[model samples]
Target: MDNQLLLSLTEKYGSPLYVYNADKIISQYNRITEAFSSVKNLKLNYAVKANSNISVLKLFNKLSSGIDTVSIQEVQLGLEAGFYPENIIYTPNGVSLQEIEQVANLGVQINIDNISILEQFGHHYPNIPVCVRINPHIMAGGNHKISVGHIDSKFGISIHQVPHIKRVVENTKMHINGIHMHTGSDILDIDVFLAATEILFNTAKEFPQIDFIDFGSGFKVPYKEGDISTNIEELGEKLSKRFNTFCKEFGKDLTLMFEPGKFLVSEAGYFLTHVNVVKQTTSTVFASVDSGFNHLIRPMLYDSYHHIHNISNPNGRERYYSVVGYICETDTFGSNRRISEIREGDVLCFNNAGAYCYTMASNYNSRYRPAEVLLYNGNDYLIRKQETFNDLIKNQVIIDLD
Candidate 1:
């Protein structure tokens, strides 16, 4: 993105803003589709949990993409964005039976992970075709917090419990239409992901009525310059062949589905904040910005690295400074990072702020959320407006204390 354009956006929309490039998003969506082009049947369900903005969902919908929703609200968003119930898969964890029934009532595909709920749902809605989430017990993600398919994780039905799942299906005559597994996020090793595929295939064999296999996506994107990312082209070549062969052996043409969130939208986002003050402490220099964990929490929450640049002084002499936010507590984004010299009022842009950033934002310290802009075809469109004091107190019931 051009620094001048971001500067203009910050000036027009104010600091602590988020800007998304629509072209990048389209290209990313294309990248995934192109990678699996060899497969006879491919379904890329845009994981709505990553970025549930209506415009973003609509963009995916415009591309004829399906939606993978983790909550009932996401399903609603997908539907409001013009996606049919058949195009949306509701896969949630640790939810109640009522919630599953609620989603099932909507006629969308329901994916049950717990055996208890599976049995209950199977009995209640045996005719409703369902998907099953399996925990392969593989530690595949970069961080334990994001990883949910390990032996001790609580995201999917354990592979050992396949017998129990089979028994439930037999008891209720439930139709199993899909087998699914998501190891975690920020996955780098193709072999590690492929290992989970084998487990999914074995689990699929238990259910002769399955029609699709969903390998939940965790493809890593480049965070910094020259950073390593998942090689989709390579994975495509290998997995497409295996999936085609598997389908042939199973005597059914199955849909190869992937629910990718970060891979589709992470790189297209840029969070722009202006440096409020350049404090030179005795120990370390802090470039305090107008935002904090309230606006972007990945740095403090997951220790994730978001590259920061001094867009206002891009060609100035470089210096090492610790970037901090204005929250009362410690909210350090980066420590001892080298960037072009930053000055008061200089704009600092954080790269890779699309996925899991705004969705996790909160009103901590009673701070208003930043505004969002979408850049499409050389034009900027304001999607979300910055919050006001009215927004802060709208939900609170205040009593007169006089």
Candidate 2:
């Protein structure tokens, strides 16, 4: 989105707002599809944990994209957005068997990650088809805190435990329909990702009835100018050929699947916050915005970098300023960043705010969550309203303390 559009959006909807560009999301979806166009059967399951707005879900649905949900609520959201159950894959972690059963009853594809859950589900519902998520023990992602494929992560079942998985399948006579693995997010090395896929392919050989192999997506997106991100085209060209060969060796064509969250929507989002004050401290200049970690926590949580620019004065002389939030914590977005001169009331645009920003927001410090807008078809629509005091205390109970 342009500066004027963003400024206008903040003026219309208010600051500390989220605006998503539909065209950008669509183009990202098409980019991946075209990258792997050679595959006979391909599926892109948008990870719902990234951005679970019903409108965003509906946009993905309009694109004919499947959903990879991690919770019962997300699965329900997918259904509410008009997605077919079969097109929605529920891959929850550390949840109860009852929740899995609940999701399964909805006819959604169940992907079990741990051996205990796998055994429990298989024993109870042997006839149901399931997918196994294997931990290939591959390390990838921008931060160690965010990486899950390592041996220490509690995410997927260890690859060494494949024999145990087989035992569970055999004892229960359960059907394994798919094999899945996710190395992590912001994967920059195609070789590392391909190595992880080799492990998934090797594990897939154990399940003859599998119809799909999901190489869980962690394709990185550029976070800053000239930032090095995953080379989707090159990875696709090499992996597509390898996948086709693997299908031949398996003696059957299997559907290739990717569950991308950030890669598809990160660049499409913009977080516009109004500069509340310009504080000149002893040795640093702090441009504090009205919002804080309550609204965008990636910087504090994962040390994630979201490009910040002064959209209101793009051509002004540049200066070093530390962008901070009003939250009563060490909530800093950027430190010592050179941007154009920022004045009070000027709207600053945070780039790549699409994927995990809004979904991770909370009502911390009793602050209200911001509203969301969608720029679709040359029109802007407010997808979510700014939370009010009523929203904050809606579910809260106050005791009669007389």
Candidate 3:
């Protein structure tokens, strides 16, 4: 987006804002589907936990995409966004059986990843079909924090425990309709995913009534220029052939599904924040912004990299500086990064802020959450307003301190 237009947006709405380009999102969604168009039955489920914005969710629905929900509230949000209950899949981690049962009552597809929960839910609801999340014990992304399919990870039932799962299903007479596996996020190797897919294919053989296999999405997007990303085209070509063969061998056509969150919207999002102060010490120059981790915590929480540029001075001489936030504790976005000359009140735009950014925002230190905007057809529309003091205390009980 034009720097002047972004500056105008900050002036018109407020600083510390999230701006998304709907066109970018559409293009990304089309790209993924086109890549996998060869598949007979392909299902793309937008991971609602990524951005959960009703507008974003509605946009996905308009794209004819299914929803991947991890909570009952997300299932409700999907329904509110105009998705049929049958089109939504619930894949929550470590939630209660009551919550699962509640969402199941709404008729959304349920995915069970734990052996104990599988037995319990199956025993209680024997007729309801469930998807099984398997842990292939494959290490992906190399980051322990993001890797979920390793042996020690708690995100899925272990492949070694397949006998246990089969025993539970047989004992409870539960119907298994789908087999699923998610290795981790920021996946760069298609071979690792294919290996995990092989595990899922093998597991699906145990459940003769299965209708689909969800290879949970972690397809990496380029965080910066020249950064290695997932090769979706090649993956589609290879996986499509394998999936078709599997379907043929299994004597039925099955749905191939993925739940992509970051891939569809990360590039579509831009986080805009105004420079509040320029602090210079003997050793460091800190470019402090009006927002903190309360607004975007990826840097502090995940050691993630978000490419920041000085939109205000695109042509200015680049200099290395430390970008920090106004939070009370240590909050550093990047250390010793070269950016264009920054000035007080200048707008710095952070790329790749679409997924897991706003949805993870908090009210720490009583800081109001930033506003959100959607840019469509070269026009800016304010989708969410900046929080006020009332929002900070809306749920608090101000008990009398006599």
Model 2 lDDT tens row, 264-344: 999999999999999998999999999999999999999999999999999999999999999998999999999999999
As a whole number from 0 to 100, the lDDT of residue 31 in candidate 1 is: 90
Give per-model TM-scores.
0.99, 0.99, 0.98
Residue 22 displacement (Å), model 1: 0.9
lDDT of 1 at 301: 85
* Candidate 3 global CA lDDT score: 0.92
**Predictions in order: lDDT:** 0.93, 0.96, 0.92
- Listed per candidate, the RMSD to the true structure in angstroms reads 0.9, 0.7, 1.0
Global fold similarity of model 3 (TM-score):
0.98
- The window of 10 residues in a row where model 2 has the poorest summed lDDT is 139-148
TM-score of 1: 0.99
Residue 159 CA displacement from its true place in model 2, Å: 0.7
In candidate 3, position 375 carries an lDDT of 90
lDDT of 1: 0.93
